[model samples]
Structure formats: structure tokens, C-alpha cells
Target: MAKATIKQVAAEAGVSTATISRVLNSSGYVSREVKQRVMAAVTKLHYQPNAIARSLKQDKSFTIGVVLPDISNPFFMTICRGIEDIVQEQGYHLLFCSSDEKPEKEEQLLHLMVEKRVDAIVLATTGGNEELITRLAASGVCFILVDRRLELELSESGAVVDLVAEDDVYGAYELTKQLILAGHSVIGVINGCMGVSTGQDRFVGYLKAIHEAGLEHDPALLYDGHFTEAGGRAAVRYFLQMAKPPSALLSFNNKMTFGALVELTESGRDIPGDIAIASYGEIEAARLLKHSGIMYVDQKPYDLGIKAGQTVLHRLEKGLDKSLDRDAASPEPEPIRDILQPALKTLPS
Candidate 1:
């Protein structure tokens, strides 16, 4: 049987196709009675709205592109779930891509999504590619940055795209202070990639905490792990080989923390016994490492995701229309920035 079309639904409901569209899109004002009648006809006809047809008519794909660094990371996965909860309900689909922490790859993925004409893109950028970003902004694709924001050309024009992230600097400072209070002055840090703001700010927090405690901040005690498990393991190796190894270690993130654990366990170094360790986020072995004195900050990744989703959808629904921004000089909508404060949680030793 041929599927019921919008025209058929309008005829059945005794209304214009524009009225049916208003009801279907839930946009504009429609009388409650008219809405009910339209829906009744829609149900009676078993008519399904064709997204493709709507896209062609409205010049919108009704799809959101989500590009992040690591797909395997549980934090990002949970964030996606939060975004999905809001976006899916509003008749929007999600197009997901993982950049694997490479700047060029991130740019490639963004370009591909732009080509596909996604209504908006939620990106956790790798802190590179200003040229690409400039082009994307000029093209007028709505964008929201999640977890990390790159130091690109957007801020120069004061073109702040929507961003949702944790307070990494304060969270890191708070975490380090706790370690200091625990009586560890000589602390070693396994830091993540310095390319992104999260990495740079978190390290800054560690420095602030160390200086505040009046502890000797040794240059040799620092290790750049490049935000990888292998980097974490290498940092541990370097720390263990030190003539006077740090009594306490701070892993910048969850993945690095797990790597630190692997090194500690393999080398027969007892946790909080031989050395103490903590991190900014939870590890995969959080359960098994319960008695290991591994601390983490609850960043509420899922909540952050939901907020990011809300920001992008609001921009799409309210700010812009299907008519793309052709003029570069027009004052774009102010970008929204929401930062959730992180709380420290310690796993008992």
C-alpha cells in the first residue's frame, strides 16, 4: 500500500499542508483542537513523516554530527548517551565519528560532516586546525565544543561557539591539594597531551597546588604522557627509575591512571604502600583498585553531554534558519559556555 503523504493527511484533517507541517514540526502556533485533529488523521492514515523530503524542502538534514577524540573512552560514551537522550527526542539523528586524538583526522571528519550538511556539529576538538575552523564558521554550520576547546580563530572575532566542559583547572588544583594534605610533598605527575586546554589547565592546577603547599616542585618529576596508556606506563618507568622516586603520583586522567596502575602492579610496587596515586577521572579498574588509594574527580560527563546537546539544539531551533549565513560580517549569536564544577572522590586504600 502507498504510504500516506502530508497532502493526504492535510486533506483528511481538512487543513492546509502548511498547517499540517506546523503540527508535524511542532513549530509556529496551532490551535490545540487543530493539532489533535491533525494527529488523529496522521494516526488514522498510519503516515510517517519523511525526513528526506522535509530536508529537501527546509534545506536542513535534521541530523547532528558528534565528533570526539576517543570512542573507546567510557567518559565520551556516557556523554554521547546524554546528548542522545535530548537530541533523539526532538526528531534529530546523531552522526558519530572518532578522531583518535589526531588533529588532521579531526579536521577531515569535520569537513566530511559539513559536506554531508549536518544541521550542527558537537566537536571535542584536538586543539589544532584554525584554518579549517575558520572555513567551517564562515560556512555557517552550527557547532558546539564538548569537554575540550581548541585555541582557534573563533575567539578573535569573539565568535564563541557553544562549549560544555568541566572545571579542569580548579578540579586539578583541588585534587593536588588533597594529595598534599595527605603529606606527600615530592609528587610526580603523569600529564596528558599539552595540545588541548584541559591538559594545559590541569597541569597549571598541579603547579598551583604544589606552590601553595610550599613544596619543592622538581622539573624532573614531571612526565608528559601524551594522553595515552603507553605514555602513562613510560612515565611510571621513569618515576620508578628516579634516584629518589616521588612518594605520591598524580595521573592527569583516567586512561593514564590505568597505565600507571599497570606499571605499578607489574613492577611489584604496592599502592599507597610503596607509592600513592590519584587521577582526574575514573579508571577502568576502578572496582579492582578500590583498596589502592586511587582517587578521581567526578566530572559528571553525562550531564555535560546533555547540556552540550541542549545548546546545539537551541541554536538550531531558535537562532538560525535554513537560510545559511552568507555574510561573514553579520553579528552571529553569542556562543554559550557552561562549565560544571568537578568534585573529588577517593577510592579507599
Candidate 2:
């Protein structure tokens, strides 16, 4: 039996070799119906689009590329697990890379993935280049934006994108409201930088809750945590040095909370006794903090990742439904946006 070739696959599918090439490359405007026929024929023959046999740049690599920020973070890693659960079963290999929260690093990684001819990309995104992302998605390589998303200006870019993330506003609002309801008027926040969308949403939710309670919004209490543990530690130091430190504190994400907790423990302050603490995400090393009260939201990181994986797979294999065509809307490829709610829990002091 002669090994299957593109020409053979095209003959088997009863379509022109040119059409077969376009479908395998996922290029041009072939109707889904025709695409399916070509794919079926290729599958029946167990065809492999080897670089030696054809134009390597135009063939589907059958690999999914993943780009994330702070790969050390368990939240994102759990999301990766979720994604792997689905994509791996479909016989798609995953190539994971970390952006280290740098947009330039992410850009470099993206180019590398394209150069390698990955079929699709699932990105946590550091923002800073919406047009590039749009073009890549429209260029036949599928892109799914997960975790942090593109800024609003490009949220509706005329490109097909899938987004799965935590509902930042909801998580922040719930945490802030919990502290306010507990009778803490003097509250401080270890917040992510406002330039980031997640950071901005969390801050806005904090403000919304504060305003609803008719409390004066004090700029002095706002500490930019810069989405880092060091930032949280520094915020803790700044707040502690104040003549009147806030009675309660809120850290936007778990990492910063860990930093603040470390600083507070060293300073001999008691949790919920000397001060109350609430945060948007869970803290690590729970055993060490047994004596302290720490309320946190479960960002559902793992489940969020699974959803992202499914969304990307859907776009690649099944494609998007015409009713919600992302390209038809201002955003073009209609984003299959999934926002999971963060569940709140608390430890008694």
C-alpha cells in the first residue's frame, strides 16, 4: 500500500487537490461543508501532513500552543491541567510557554509558535498588541484568550477569539462587601496595577462596594500591589507605618495576600484581632496561618482552564456557529466568553 499523499487524499475525498490543500491549511473561505469532506478523506487515509511531503508552512501541525503569565502561579497551572484534559484526548500536543508578565516576551513566544506552525494558541495574555493578535487569528491560526483578556479597545476587534476568565468584578465586590458589612470603615487594598484589565476590574468593584456603603474613598488606603508578592509586602509596610492603619485589608489576588500575611506575622499583629483581612483569591500555606482569619475567593482556576481548552478545540474542529460569528460583529470572530464566578470562603480568627 502506497503511503497516503495530498493528491491521493484529494482523489479519495472526490475534491480537487487545491481544495484539499486549502482545507488542510485552514486557509481561505472554504465552506464548513467542504472542509469537513476534505478532513474526512484525510482521516480515512490516516494522512500525515509531513513537512518533507508538502509545504510545511501551510499544513496543520496538530499542536496547540499555550502562553501564560507567571507560570509559577498555581492558578494558571491548574488552568493548564484543565486544558490538557480536553486537548490531549483529541490527539493535539500542547506546547506551554511563560510570558513572565511581559508583553514583549509574549510577543516573542507568539512568533515562535507561528514559526513552528502550531494549529492554535491559548493565551493568558499580557495585552499590548491587539492588532497583532487580531491578524494572527484572522490569518488561519486560531487564538483563544484566557485568564486576563484584551483591553476594551480591542475586545471587539474584528477577529475570532475565545475568552475564559474569572469574573474579576464579582470577586472584588464580594470581598470588599464582606469587609464593609463586618463594620470595617478603615480598609486598605493591596491591588494589582490598574493598567491590567483584571486589576482595573477588581479596583472598580472595590470602589463600587465602597460607594454603596457611603464611605469616603481614601486614596491613601490604595496600595498598588503590582500583582507581585513584593508589592504586597511593601503595601503592608506602608499601611503599618501609618498613624492610623486600616482596621481591615483586602488583597486583590492570593500572591499579594501571602506577602501581606508574611509582613503582618513578622510585625506581631493578630489577624481579625489587630486587623481583619479578606482577599480576592486563596492564600497558600494554610497550616501556618491557622491562628489568623483569612477570607478568600476560589477563582475556580482549574475549571476555567478546562473551559478554555474546550473553547479552543471547538473553534478548531467544529468551528464557530454562524449565529454568533465573531467576525460579523465588531469583534469579528465572536468570542465564546466564559466568566466563572469566584466562591468566597473564610477562616475564623
User: Which residue pairs in candidate 1 have backbone atoms (N, alpha carbon, C) closer than 3 angstroms, thus clashing?
Assistant: none
Clash pairs (backbone) in predicted model 2: 156-331, 159-333, 160-333, 326-332, 326-333, 326-334, 327-332, 327-333
Model 1 scores a C-alpha lDDT of: 0.86
Candidate 1 Cα RMSD after full superposition onto the native fold (Å): 4.9
lDDT per residue (tens digit) for residues 18-126 in model 2 = 8987887677778888888898998899988765345365366668889988788888888889999988898777899998878889899999989877778999887
Highest lDDT model number = 1
What's the TM-score of every candidate structure? 0.82, 0.79
- Write down the TM-score for model 2: 0.79
